[model samples]
Target: MASIELKNVIKRYGKGKTANQVIHGVNAHIADGEFIVIVGPSGCGKSTLLRMVAGLEEITEGDICIGGRVVNQLEPAERDIAMVFQNYALYPHMSVFDNMAYGLKIAKVPVDDIKSRVDKAAKILELGPYLQRKPRELSGGQRQRVAMGRAIVRQPQVFLFDEPLSNLDAKLRAQTRLEIQKLHRELGITSLFVTHDQVEAMTLAQRMIVMNGGVMEQFGTPEEVYTRPATTFVASFIGSPPMNLLKDAPDAKPGVITGIRPEHLDITPSGWALQVEAVEMLGAERLVYGRWAHSATDQLVIIRTEEAHAVPVLGTTIHVTPRADRLHAFDAATGKRMMTA
Candidate 1:
């Protein structure tokens, strides 16, 4: 395993006045053996950043170092990294064992050594039974495992995953996620995963980089990013029901917005009066959407509570209180978090 560093990385297309800059200056230091997930919505440059690290894309500026070596001039093959892509680019006619061993064979590795490596990877991925089967005969989940197995046999210093689980169904995705976690524990290779799914980033990352509009919005552990979002975009984007940003919240300053997560609000006899707009039952939890009774605009506030809690009647005004300690403040214009005094 080796540490990877990105120093003020930037990416741009075209030249001169026609240049369309995508990735802004991004700086991050990922520790050795760390599993880092780069997450954001589509077109956020998360994949572009990963491609740069893998040497698949030329860096327009700044430096990318892997294992303390400057790899800007290095080709993808020389970067000592194995990548697993969203599409399982498997050889349909080749059996699983042969597909996994093809790279080693091309490198002129000994037949016995190749067999040993392929066997070890197959065992780890629980694909020993499917080794002789062709890619067309395997299930989607099994195919993905084969792709991962192919990478494992190489035993590279780093592993790059570009939405590797995107093709699976929800159940398969969950199952594959656990398998990936187990795989990481067993082979401890430094990994960088790029995904648009926040659930993947939250569950798999040792640290996560949240990107937006080609900029690195924030980089930190899952808890840090969730509890203390650095900006309003993160606050709204990371959660399921998302945080409520109230422009006309009680005592909120003219240039500021009050942010509150749905779970942080409580039904009370007296507090901010809100008119219940709608209520949704979601398994064990109930989500209550309400509009501020006093605010002129129609922005809605949501409250998440256990199903046992009484659901407020629609169109009826109810009092709800926000936990003082749980409230987040942000500058309205800049959309940046405002630190409490």
Candidate 2:
């Protein structure tokens, strides 16, 4: 296992006046054997940054070090890293055993050693029974495991995953997530996974790098990112329904934004009156969507409540109160969180 470091990393396309910069000075210190997920919306440079770390893309500036050695000029094969792509890039005609053993064979490892490594990886991934089956003969989840098994046999210093679970069904994705977590616990390899899904990032990452428009929004534990976001973008992007930003709220200074999560707002006898616009039933809980009553602006608000609670009728006004301790204050002009007085 190895620790990875990124110092002032940047990526740019073209050159000179027409150059378009993508990644903007990303910096992080990934501990040995730590699993970090790079998460953001599409076109946010998450994949680009992962590719840069894997030596698949050139770094425009700064240093990338693996196991304390700088690798800015190293080729992909020389970086001693294994990558599992979104698509299972398995050869159609090769059996699972051959697929897993291909890298060892290319490196001219001893025949016996190759067999041992392939067998161990197959057992770990539960693909021992499908060793003889071709890629076409296996299910999507099985094929994905085969791809992972191939990576495990290499025993690389770091593992890079580029949205590896995006292709799987929801149930399979959840199951595979658990499997990946178990694999990490057992092998304890340093891994960096890139995904556009916040739920996956929150569940699978020991820590996460949240990106937006090539800039590093925040890098922290899931709890910290969700509980105390560094900026308005992080506040709105990390949650499911997202944090609500009330502009020009009552008793608030002009140009200040107040952020509160859906679950933190509760129906009360007296508070901000919400005019219900819509309701959505989601299993054990319901989502109430509405606007603050008597306000000229149409800023929307969402409240989450248990299904057992009485559902408020559409068009009816109900009072909702935000938990004071849970509220976040930000500077609307800069979209940055404000320090409380």
Candidate 3:
């Protein structure tokens, strides 16, 4: 395991007046053996950042260090980091054992050592029974496992995952997430995972970095990012149904935009009055869609409640309010959080 650090990293394409900057001096520290997830919407530079760390992309300026050594000039193979891609880049004709052993063999590792390493990784990944099976014979999840096992067998200083579960179905994604968590626990390698899915980032990361338009918006534990979002962008991006951010009354000066998560808003008899527009039953939870009666715009709010059986009927006079300390306020123009305002 090794600590990875990015010091004022910047990336740009082309030059002069036409130069397009994709990363704007990003700085982050990934501690030894820690799992860090980089999350954001598409085109936010999360994947670009990860690619830079893996030496697939060149850094325009600043340093990338792994195990306290600057690796700005090192080739990817020399960087000693193993990466698992989103598409599970496995060899179709190679058996699972060969796929896992390929890297070691390429490095001229002894045949006996390659066998030992492959066997160990297969056992850890529960792929022992599929050693002789080719990639075409394996299921999607199994192919993913083989990809991870290939990375594991290398024993690299860092493990980098680039949306490795994006190709899986919802059920398989959940199951594979557990497997990944277990694999991380057992291997204890410093890992950096990049994904656009907020749920995946929240569930898999020890700490997460939220990026927007090539800048770091927030970096914190999942709870911190979810509960006390540093910016309105994060507030609206990190949740399932997402947090409702409504513009405050225009007459109120320095009036902040108020945010409330779906789960935080509850139905009350005597609360902020709203007109229930629709109700969606999601088996375990009900999504109450409505608009404040006083609002002039058509901004809708979503309320997720566990009481599906007792959900308010549509077209009824409904009252909804947030739990104490659940309200989030943001600057109307800047989109920055106004927690103290």
- The stretch of ten residues in a row with the least summed lDDT in candidate 3 is 247-256
lDDT of 2 by residue, 1-341 (tens): 89999999999999999999999999999999999999999999999999999999999999999999999999999999999999999999889899999989999999999999999988888999999999999999999999999999999999999999999999999999999999999999999999999999999999999999999999999999999898999999999999998886677788889889999999999998889999999999999998885655768899999988899999999889898889889998999889542
lDDT of 1 at 123: 96
For all predicted structures, in order, the TM-scores are 0.98, 0.98, 0.96
Clash pairs (backbone) in predicted model 3 = none
- Per-model C-alpha RMSD: 1.0, 1.0, 1.6
**lDDT string, candidate 3, 52-166, tens digits:** 9999999999999999999999999999999999988898889999999998999999999899999999998899999999999999999999999999989999999999999
Give the clash count for each candidate.
Answer: 0, 0, 0
Residues 2-54, candidate 1, lDDT per residue (tens digit)?
A: 99999999999989999999999999999999999999999999999999999
Shift in Å, residue 84, candidate 3: 0.4
Candidate 1 displacement at residue 321 in angstroms = 0.4
Q: Select the stronger candidate by lDDT from 2 and 3.
A: 2
The reply for model 3, stretches above 4 Å from the true place, is: 249-253
